[model samples]
Target chain A: MEIADDSKNSKRVVFVTVGTTLFDALVRAVDTQEVRQELYAKGYTHLLIQIGRGSYIPARSTSDNGSVAVEYFTFSSSIAESLRSASLVISHAGSGSIFETLRLRKPLIVVVNEDLMDNHQEELAEELAERKHLFCAHPRTLHQTIASMNLDSLLPYPAGDAKPVSKLINKFLGFPED
Target chain B: MMRENQWLTSMAESNGIAVIVVTVLTLILVRLLYVLNRCGKSLRPTTVKPLSTLIVLGSGGHTAEMINLLLELQKDRFMPRYYVAAATDNMSLQKARTFESSSSSEKGTPAQYMQIYRSREVGQSYLTSVGTTLIAIAHALWLMIKIRPEVILCNGPGTCIPLCAIAFMFKVLGIRWSSIFYVESIARVKRLSLSGLLLYKLGIADQLYVQWPQLQRKYPRSIYVGCLM
Candidate 1:
């Protein structure tokens, strides 16, 4: 598990978990320490990092190039629990991760996996974008989306209402009401 | 007396036009009813055995949704213990385990979970695809004999093929059968995929639960259930 130094001090932290798959393209696209520093300079302590499965370390650190505190990690159950507990979660559009985040009612920012053969994640991101419950950022629009993100304005599903989907399923299976 | 005569003439003309319009409308309604009745008769319900055990076959996000639905149903009078045949080792199983554990903590009934036999390791070969399907068929048959579910509710694609084939074999062996295919959401514009084609070929499904009203034309025996989660 890789922990960011800034995460310890930041008031408003952005936690990310990207799995290790030997694919560095996704991590490289949004691994911006400069943007994190910019946000920190604006009095917004932003800790942007990749931690968990499919993460790879690039040769040169983004911070060394005058970027902010961005970190990376491999898979760990404890780290995942911490990511879930964060104020906001930024992650790839993997269904398992996204569903877990949604179940917790945490504000989410999903960056789609475009390099994959199927554009399934892209489709899912677009659908969620229409619902206005999540923030979607592509490589082209990451800077703008990050700048515009209003943490206070985020409205996740009410805690108890997370099971509406499960209830809907019950009705479909012709389960008699209790 | 002359004014009275003109009034009668106007009333007679209006009545004649009304009769003609009603006749035309009745003819159209009768024709429409005939077509609908023909369709209804063609989709006659085949007798299916009562399903004691249900096997849901899917992978990925759709599978997660399906499992959640199944777990919810297990709480009620309809407790159909399920067997999941996943195409890949997706997160659906993990999510399912979490859901089951959470539910078990609340109540006490452990949600039953089982994995179907797959012929080959993940991403082995195209040749293994056929073998995996055969294994799926054998497993389904063994389960059907052991538990004997009358209806198999298919979410989509991969799992449906083997299950439906086994169900058809069961039907030939004098066991009654039925199937329900649940469509989650309808696309604004309909585009048919290879899986959709396979669904049509199965020809054993008795009812299709379509989420969108516009998709009614696609399935012969469709019931509009709005969005099915």
Candidate 2:
């Protein structure tokens, strides 16, 4: 399935992508029926989903106009194109996903893996949040955060003056460059 | 009747032998338990720093593990001045350079890496082992004199033996050299042969850091500090 190039339904359509394991958890966490009904009431037409490795999020079809479609996993090229076409991107906080969303300048909501030890992803999300690059929510707050988000305003701008390597080096050296 | 008497005498002798064996075994078990109890007290993770700079001697995996530990240690109160001594032209030195750069940047620790040349071949023969050991000894002595580090931590197999020997000699010269032997992992014990055995027995190191629980019983001065890494 492809996002239309016309940008006519840009505001009406939301693109959600998740890695397989996290997608399942996210699907279980949200009230799929309520979400469908809410989108239907709002007159939204389409929900585009890109499934991760072995994930399959079942479609909830209450209206003929509004439908959720799952796209099969393909190569990075197609995925990058899909991300570029997306109006709002919801994704797991994997480095690749975060990087792609930033590179594409998409409105992104990043959900971190709480199951993992060290909470390294939380650190990454916090760092990005400080830069105003992405919106972050834990699984607990995901539904409300996603619903309340102002997508148009939150669209990522160019990464103005953040140079990650230099920042990392400076942090390590305990001295910032003059 | 004569055969019955002989059988009774034989049974009595066997019973006496069994009693002697049981007594000896009981004494050994008691001694072993006492030793274990003593070691258990000492092996508790107490914060102790080498008196001087911790010179990690070796190259490759052992050095890598040591560097990782050093990085972890830099996060806490005990900040020991450290240097890595490696063979000139060792590939591990290149890896060490990358680690040192990245680690120094991340942790803000001022750790330096250096290479030392061996005056003789380390793996030719017993005589060469001796000669190489002497050259390594001389190199270490010069380094200790220049750096004046109180402790020389040995991570190398052949090179460390000599360095520790030199440290012992320096101890004789009234220089207090606290030597530490870091056994990488339990798996390494199976790989050690005659020389490793000798190094294990000579016990030059003031404290031996072992990763395995089983080794705690073998080395009297060993501190089972979990995994160094």
Candidate 3:
């Protein structure tokens, strides 16, 4: 297969990191032909995925220019770098991923794995979405949600004040508050 | 008759030694308490200098919650901070790095990070847990002595137990001046986690805080501080 010059040099990259836990559902959803075509149509030149310990390996798809566009692995030591270069981030609703993405002020779509036992990610995702920081979807709705997502509506991540924590720390340290 | 006489003589000598040992132990205990009291007085809230704090960052959700809590702390007040992680938990270390990098970039001061051995993971066997816990105690002791933090903070995790135990022992021995502050994780809305139960039941923590009012009713001493994270 010959690679297309347009895809080879295209700038838009999507990063999806599912953290260290096995999130096969998210991987399978993202790997469907429909989702891949939608992403390609939207000008996503590259899709870098960190699938964790998930068993389902995404099949490599070659463009007309034979450039392998969608790349995935079990894990990476360079997740931070990937996050920096991404135009959009789709991630599990893990707090580490959420906070890091927010810190970088990236357009984020969080898909919570409801299959997890006693997962509080749903609560966090709902709260963050309500605050307009990011758009969230369950694993079942991830593909549809991403396909229809409007990047323009996302609110930039907000900075947090130290007031609440400061009060707690002061009290713990036995310092009387002014 | 000769055996009876020897037994009486042996008992008398052992009794004398026991009396001497008790007297000496009591005297040492009194002296230790006096010295500790003096040291505690020096740690009054009026100290102008900033404090060195030690915080335990457990894996996964615990790490995220602790980082959130640390973000709210007045960075200027917590000098030379230390964050502890378990040896096998690379994910926690990575999460902690975000805090270190963000703080250093923003304020030019980076926290000291250390990883110690974990007593046991949830599914590990009881026999291995015992062996690893002993090793964890030694590591915890060495780190605690090296840091000698004025305040030690942790949420609930098995790793924190050994470290807190060592800190509590040092307090009893009057060899260190540090206060243990335990904040129950927000996830534990009903009952305390295993670590929390141990620390609270043993009265090891100087301050115990619960994240919800429901838990406060269960543990009388645990102050409900709402949600810190």
What's the C-alpha lDDT at position A21 in model 2?
Answer: 34
Stretches > 4 Å off in candidate 1: A1-9, A19-23, A33-55, A58-67, A78-80, A148-178, B1-51, B57-60, B74-76, B87-112, B117-145, B153-157, B176-178, B181-197, B200-229
Candidate 3: give the clashing pairs.
A2-A64, A2-A65, A2-A66, A3-A64, A3-A65, A3-A66, A4-A65
For candidate 1, lDDT tens digit of each residue in B161-211? 566566655554446433344444222113233344455544444344454
**lDDT by residue for model 3 over A127-159, one digit each (tens)?**
668767788987677768778887767776645
Off by over 4 Å in 2: A1-178, B1-51, B75-82, B105-109, B118-123, B177-181, B184-186, B191-199, B227-229
DockQ of every predicted complex: 0.07, 0.01, 0.14
User: Ranking under DockQ, best-scoring first?
Assistant: 3, 1, 2
Docking band of candidate 1: incorrect
Candidates ranked, most accurate by lDDT first: 3, 1, 2
For model 1, residues A10-66, the per-residue Cα lDDT tens digits are 465566756433335556655655445545544444455564444456333433333
TM-score computed on alpha carbons, candidate 3: 0.65
- Give the CAPRI class of candidate 2: incorrect
Judged by DockQ cut-offs, is candidate 3 incorrect, acceptable, medium or high? Answer: incorrect
